[model samples]
Target: MSIWWSLHLRRDAASVPLARRLLLGTMETAGVDPDVSYDLSVALSEACANAVEHGGDTPDGPSEAYRVTAYLDGEKCRIEVTDSGPGFPATRDRPSIRPARTDAEHGRGLCLIQELADHVHIGNKPGRGGAVVSFDKILKWREDAPLMAV
Candidate 1:
């Protein structure tokens, strides 16, 4: 099935809930298990949040415009949040793994995204025009339980 709706909005706490409701409903209609819904929601939220914070649109503050595109194919659902800015920061200068310290009030979104999704990828446009963060989650494929001897 394809995405029912694709929305673009400003990056903010308010946007998070709206995105969650839409994704949850879409996943359920597509047959996603309830037990794993929260996981998917958390992961997607983190990805979007990261885009909100890192996506250069918010040069001074939260960028008023950011693109959020959701798509579903087969048993997997994917989302790509992009920003109109220079792609990922150079690896040497990028520190998305962890914040400066535990007490730091910022960071950790990428870490959450890594834990929530089956695959996460960050790439830059061919001309370094913008950045794209793709998130993919397996909604229906789970490892089979162990068999017991009869």
Candidate 2:
């Protein structure tokens, strides 16, 4: 069986943990391995944090909300976080992951997401204005997993 969920969340710091908890709960209930769940949860938090911090028309004027979607099917789990911000720069339609400076406290979220997930896609929301960060990872099931695919 496959499980999926989506949330329209406020672009606030508190919303980040809510999304992570939901993902972790879904993974645990579906019998995903603990390590896999941890990776996904961390990645989700980073994506959500980015949506809260940089997801806005102006740097100081952040968007009011963002969306987070998750899907667990067969042997993989996919998660996407989108925000109604100005979106990535036009020159780089698909922004490349760049390492954060050693002294920087921020800018590490995107890189962390890339490290955790098997595949990631970062781009803008076509006609509408927003940023989209989606990622997926191959799941590992526990020995006695109830929802493991046959």
- The regions of model 2 sitting more than 4 angstroms off are 58-62
lDDT of 1 by residue, 57-127 (tens): 42444346567777766666788877665557666643255433688777777777777788877766556
Residue by residue across 1-150, what tens digits does model 2's lDDT show? 799999999989999999999999998888999999999999999999999988877555757999999999899999999999998887634788899999998899889999999999999887767999999999999998999966
TM-scores for all candidates: the values are 0.74, 0.95
Highest TM-score among the candidates is held by which one? 2
TM-score of model 2 (CA atoms):
0.95
What is the Å distance of residue 119 in model 2 from its true position?
A: 0.4
RMSD values, in order shown: 6.3, 2.0
**lDDT (0 to 1) per candidate:** 0.67, 0.92
